[model samples]
Target: MARIKALVFDVFGTLVDWRTSIARESEQALTPLGIAVDWLAFADAWRDQYQPAMEEVRAGRIPFCKLDCLHRRNLDVVLADLGLDQLNEATRQQLNLAWHRLDAWPDVSAGLHALRQHYRLAPCSNGNISLMVDLARRNDFPWDAILGAEVARDYKPKPTVYLSAADAFDLRPDEVMMVAAHSSDLAAAAEAGLRTAFIARPDEYGPGLGESAATVPVDVSAGSLIALAQALSTANTPP
Candidate 1:
């Protein structure tokens, strides 16, 4: 157990509330155009395309591209599926950026602030660098850097994504902790030799639609980023 020098995070559900945020942003953008739909279901429908889209990239069926491009592509699919294909290109582009305007989880600001006192922090998200920047600025996230899929030219659960993040900080895999809400992500990071932390986002999908606990073993498990920071602080405290 080497001393963890940096903390890398999976941004989507772990740090921010993507589902709710997307739903809100979607309603705000689309309502102006008289598009009436169940906005929450719209958010779910759009998110449903996420994994399959990444699988296309991960499987080499598509050339590597930014998550923004993928989001735009997925947005097209969702729009067509929902009979909202009448939207013009400019409006579509605006809606596509809903991902950029997500609100962070309530505990995020205080937690990141606490953790930043002792460690380097960055997002190891599948989101492109610009997307990460937008979310960071929108939420006042104090990222020391942004390193993720676009930087690694691949998506997560892939070893390179985790290892590349470790390399970005010039730290050994064991010296970096990968914090995420998903157990599968932690399992992948563990396989890649990085320490893992699970911050449960039980409502990530909607009310009670997220995991309350990690299904896989992790170095740390907590209810929120603030709790995680406290757990790490306690662990580092000398007896």
Candidate 2:
């Protein structure tokens, strides 16, 4: 096979600990407003609406909109559901930007920096470019470019999201590896002819709720991004 020319990562779970970060942010931002609930459960409930909200755009039921707009809508829905719909615009917007402040996993920066020595790196997430940029800057993730839902104007599992990243580098699908924690994302990327890597994120959904490993076949699978970088380095080394 040709050497991997680029690695496109799934940002939310693979690189960042969104569950804890979102929950913490929610508690920090909303508790002072006298809206105290199970913040973790609130985070999960908000996240559960993510894909379905995007599916509206993907299905042409709604026009193309950035993930931030979708996030705002989802946040409102979650707030309404939790009986906390009385927030002002400023408060709502502040809560929405919590997605931008998600903390990266411990291995992410070092792993991406190491992997960048060998191959180009970018986030192939459902997150829009602004969201990606905020997260990247906040977490010190060194991405060569931003690619994903915003670039393709379509969410993942959509062939365009994966293929567009490869296209951005002027490379064939097989030359670009899609690195994600979700088996479904890898499967979709594989279907689009991109190489696939899965990093198990056991705490992505909060402890045991997250995926422990890929259930589908992928070109590479690792416990974390740093391990994947080491494994890839070894694979590329000559005996």
Candidate 3:
């Protein structure tokens, strides 16, 4: 096997607690406007629109746009669904930025710090560059660069997104490992000829609603980023 020279990550559920973070952010943003809804359900409802919106771009029904634009569009749909479409443009815009303020998982910072000692690191998230930058700054993520859907002009599961990230680092696909909580994502990366690692985020959707393990086989599987770092470190160590 080619030595892994870089590690790219899936940001939303893999590194950050998007469900709880979005719930908290939504309540904070909407409560002041007298909106009363189950915040977690609201978060889920908003997220449910994510894939379909991306599918529009992937299927060529729409031009490729940044995730921020897709997020804003999804936010409008969510607001309308909840009868909160009366919100002013400025308020909606501010609320749409909630994705940027998501909190990272507890193990992320230190684990990434450890991994950085051995390999180049960057986020291969579907999130736009600005969104990734905001999350990185807010969480102190040590990314070498922001390379993902925005950089590739395409979303994940598309071969270009993974290959583009590898190209950005000037590494062969086999020299890069795609770490994610979603098996589907890892499967896609493996199909694109990148190494794959899986870390389950059991509460990503809610209590026990997320994946407990990779449904597909992977090169490495661990419960947390710290453990993943340890596993990779050991595997790459000299005899």
Candidate 4:
């Protein structure tokens, strides 16, 4: 086992619940206009846009884009495809910015605070730097540092994103662990020479989150970052 000096976390669905936060705001943004849409459904659709959008960028069909722009483009497409047309340009932009106001999971702040006492904890997320900073301030996340894919000019699963942080800290790959609710994120971290820890965010994708993203059936699942900190603490002890 390796000594984990720092823990890197995924923001969306891990440190913050993008689905619920965005959907709640989406409802408020659209209800006054009588759009009659399921904001939750729209939120899910917005999240679903991530993979294909990244694929476009990865394939060179699109130029390099930040997660914020990717999210904004998807928001517009979802609104139009769902027949929602009442929003003015400014309002649409406001609605698109729901990404900036994500709510942290119940234990997130407390957990991160507790962990910060022991390790150099920071976010290693695909969100743009400005968006992550705003979210930290909005949600009061006590992260010691904020690492964004935009800083690397690439996204996770690209390898460069993970390595850039390692390069920044002047640490070897094994010294960092990526904590995430999504297994795909953990898998990427593992591939990047970082350790992997899965923190359960059961409601991340809303109430019916499936086994595909759930942790109950996974191998290295942790219920919270507090638990993750405890586990790492134990691992670091001298025998």
Candidate 5:
């Protein structure tokens, strides 16, 4: 493995339990309006909206909207689909902020703290900047920098976003390592010449990630962030 100077994490699934957090928050927010939807299923559908929503822009079906707008667009669609039409502005705004209340995955804080001692650690999520900042503060996510789709004004898997991250740190792609739970995410980083470490978010699909943990080319594969950190701490370039 090559030395890694920076660790850019895919925030949503890798470090944070976005699905659970969004679900829980949505239930609370919806309760006031006497709207009780299947929060878990709602969360799943909401997350499902993430990819195709971005693809809309990627394919030029929609203009370049930020992730926040994209998320809201999807949220509105799902809300209507679920027959939820009653919500005050205040309640609706809070619901939209569900992403900000994301709970960190187990071992996230401890591992990131350990790794941060030896490397630069930040978020490189498809989330917007304000969303990432809010999440960091809410969960005490201790990022040296908060990067998101806002930086590139576009989403990842777009090569441009990944390279934008390299540009942000004034480093070559090879000097940066992207840690993600999703193989597709890591593939983009790796193809950009960035190193990749896959920390298995085995429950990302809510329970048992359907596929086995044996996905390929993941330079370093770990069962948890803390364990991944232990490995990275020792794998740093010798001073």
Candidate 6:
């Protein structure tokens, strides 16, 4: 196998707990308005539209838009469905940015630090640059550079999105590992000639709703980012 030189990650479910964080923040933001829907369900409903919204751009039905814009549109639809559409613009904007404040998983900070010792790290997410930067600061993720959807003007599992990340580091596809909890994301990266690492995130969608394993084989599979880091460190150590 070619030596891996860098690591690019999937942000939402892979590194951050989007469901729990969004639900918590949404409840905090919406409680003032007396809108008492199931916040977790509300989060799921909003996320349910994620891929389809990206598909619109991917298929040329809409031009490229940041994930924040797509998230705002998705938020409005959910609010309308919940019959709580009376929220003012400021409130809606705050709620829309819930994605920006998502907390990293417990293992992420240390794991990324460890991996950063041996490889460059960045988020190759569908999230735009500003969103990724905000999340990185919020979570203290140490990334070498930001590269993903906005940079490519496209979303994953699009080939351009994956290839663009590799190009950003001036590295060949196989020299950078695409680390994600989602099998399809890794599959797309594999198709683009990048190496793959699957880190299981079984609670990404709220207990048991996330994937525990990759649907296909990957170059590495671990229970968390820390495990991946340890495995890689061990592999690189000389006898």
Residue-level lDDT tens digits of model 6 in 112-153 = 999998899989999999999999999889999999999999
Error of 1 at 228 (Å): 0.8
Candidate 2 residue pairs that clash: none
The parts of candidate 1 lying over 4 Å away from their true place are: none
Give the per-residue lDDT digits (tens) of candidate 1, residues 1-239: 23999999999999999999999999999898898899899999999999999999999999999999999999999999888889999999999999999999999988999999999999999999999999999888999999999989999988999999999999999999999999999999999999999998999998899989999999999998899988999999888
User: Which digits, one per residue and each the tens of the lDDT, describe model 4 over residues 1-239?
Assistant: 45667778888888888887888998898788776677788889999998888878767788888888998888788878877665688888898789998888888888888888877877888888889899889877887777858877777778888878776677787887777888777777788888777887766776657223443232356788778777767766889
TM-score, cand. 1 vs. native: 0.98
- How far is 77's C-alpha from truth in model 4 (Å)? 0.9
Residue 161, model 4: Cα distance from true site in angstroms? 0.8
Question: What overall lDDT goes with each candidate model?
Answer: 0.94, 0.92, 0.94, 0.79, 0.81, 0.93
* Runs in model 2 lying further than 4 Å from the true structure: none
lDDT of predicted model 3: 0.94
C-alpha RMSD of each candidate structure in angstroms: 0.8, 0.9, 0.9, 2.3, 1.9, 1.0
By lDDT rank, best first, the candidates go 3, 1, 6, 2, 5, 4
What value does the lDDT take at residue 49 in candidate 3?
A: 98
The superposed Cα distance between candidate 2 and the true structure at residue 208, in angstroms, equals: 1.5
Clashes per candidate, residues 3 or more apart or on different chains: 0, 0, 0, 0, 0, 0
Better candidate number, 1 or 6, judged by lDDT? 1
Worst 10 residues of 2 by lDDT: 1-10
